[model samples]
Target: MLANKRILLIIGGGIAAYKTPDLIRRLRERGASVTPVLTSAGAEFVTPLTVAAVAGTPVHTQLFDLTTEAEMGHIQLSRSADLVIVAPATADLMAKMANGLANDLASTLLMATDTPVMIAPAMNVRMWDHPATQRNLATLKADGIRVIGPNEGDMACGEYGPGRMSEPLEIVAAAEAALSDGPLKGKRVIVTSGPTQEPIDPVRYISNRSSGAQGTAIGKALVALGAEVVFVTGPADVPPPEGVQVVRVETAVQMLDAVQAALPADAAVFAAAVADWRVAQAASSKMKKEKGEIPTLSFAENPDILATVSQMTKGRPPLVVGFAAETDNVIAHATAKRLRKGCDWIVANDVSPATGTFGGTQNTVHVISDDGVEDWPKMAKDAVAERLAQRIAGALVG
Candidate 1:
């Protein structure tokens, strides 16, 4: 899809810099020609020789390298690509860009470019959450900059938080999504995500193994296509995308309420792994074990959020999407779900032990519609989401 695309990839300083080589490889594999620009601090993390070996070209390092500047110059470099991308966009670089500081080669090119810019940030969790960083992020978003990541997970610092950069393959997918035309512009989209936790007591709750990555990526892709997104998310480890209007909920009831509130949207995706049942009667206080034997607990079906929204009377969404997680007979279950839920489409993924679809970073999905089933190969969740978003956009605009 990226054939003949000129991608200017800027490497920023971060521990995740090691991923740059593989990023170049993946981009090249997809037929996009990569031109790398390295920041001063970025050079400290990875050798220029290493980058050149993978990108097959000398890395641009200086804003005023006399010999090179005499030829293309920084201004020429700025406009040479179809899109400019920054991977491992450090806190320092983000702040610089937000403030329009062009002291370095990367920031200078970024400031001068008329092309759309995308960034994949990686930094310490605290740095990512600092007030200053937050303020800068707001500035960048308001200025129409595109950001891909800084996903949440266990960081190299032995901390589990929201500062790890998205994988290289996912970064390439984001780049492709950036190149895609804004077919969903002016449309409204709603996507629900994560596992809704139903409170069992003061301290305990019933939940599932959903990580919210796929659904959140779908929301981001919708936003990228110029859609106003209403992202109803359960408790998630990653921060919501900057432009979307987010609603945080913790149970099936809460999620259902949020989905109803987000109606009238052009497209709606129920990607959340909502609990099928909640405690029949939740105890206000913590339930204590009296004996060695386990206590018997009653269960009750929770609200079917997807079905309710699919059949809503008041400004129902034009296209309704549901997700089916099945252990066996995946295709059969997914097709059944599409009819039963009254949704326009259903994405099916195997969550059996062999597949590990519940909380893994990757997913292999079958996009089932009335037309037929499109079996998407195993890929990072973000790629699937972006492709799904593109499909939705085509339907909406057509």
Candidate 2:
């Protein structure tokens, strides 16, 4: 997807450093040129020749290399790219960036370059969750740095949680999107996603069929476009996006609290399939089956979060977006819901037995607004998110 793009690829120390060679080749195949810079730790796992061979360029290593000074000055090298990427970004590298440590060539180039920077962190699970590392990550995000995965999976350390480098293909897509002038830049957007689990006991509750793929994709697309995204997620089957600010919640009440905290955004997208009813009085302990004939459960209504946000007079988002998952008369009901809830738009899609849109990667969605309903062709969740994000930005800046 990246054509005619220049990327400064900095390889950091970690087992994941081995993937950088293939990463370089993929970038070149997509018509992007890569200038490789190796960290001291990176050299231990992979040789300089391997990187140079794949990059088809002489690798840059030292901070005070006399040969490189005679040819390409460090100043020239730092700003020659459209983007800077640090793959296999170790905890040390992350801390160094956070503290503005410029002792090394890679760290110095990072601080000196004005171009947008992206990092794909690869560290042990414990290191990833360390208080210092977490604080550093928050600092980086607040500074407008874009980060890709450090995804959750089996690691070289024989542990699994959330500290694996993103696949090369995934990083390439982010690079392509960053180089392009996205249509949704500069919009402040909020998206609520997934099923809320209301507690019946400590162990049981009610939820929905929301897989959360579409909602999280929307957040990612907005972030890629330079929009400020606040993702309020419930008990989602999928994890949140890499760069967006995520507020995790479980019950409907908790979701409301998160929404209020993320307010004053430009747009609010209520994509979560929140449960309509919850247990009024949940037992602390699991009920014994021996004494019960059949449990008569008491139910109560959940607060209409979409309507509340839509009707807010102060600190309300400009364009409020909501979703309607209906069995019949989908468009008509969704259109009525928009009017009733005072929202600007509603995206209606069939979640019935015949259709597999629920929890599926592909969706055929109908966009309902005051203008009219537009039947969009079936597309991937990520594509849908981009289109919606673009429209949100257009509406905000119109």
- lDDT of all predictions: 0.85, 0.84
Give the poorly placed runs of model 2, Cα more than 4 Å off. Answer: 70-72, 185-205, 211-268, 276-320, 326-344, 349-390
lDDT of 1: 0.85
Query: How would you encode candidate 2's per-residue C-alpha lDDT over 84-172 as one tens digit per residue?
Result: 99998899998989999998889989888888888889999999889999889877865767667676689999998778888887677
Among residues 3 or more apart in sequence or in different chains, the pairs in candidate 1 whose N, CA or C atoms overlap within 3 Å are none
Candidate maximizing TM-score: 2
Steric overlap count per candidate? 0, 0
Model 1: residues with Cα > 4 Å off, grouped in runs = 185-190, 199-203, 208-287, 291-398
> Ten-residue segment with the worst summed lDDT in candidate 2?
179-188
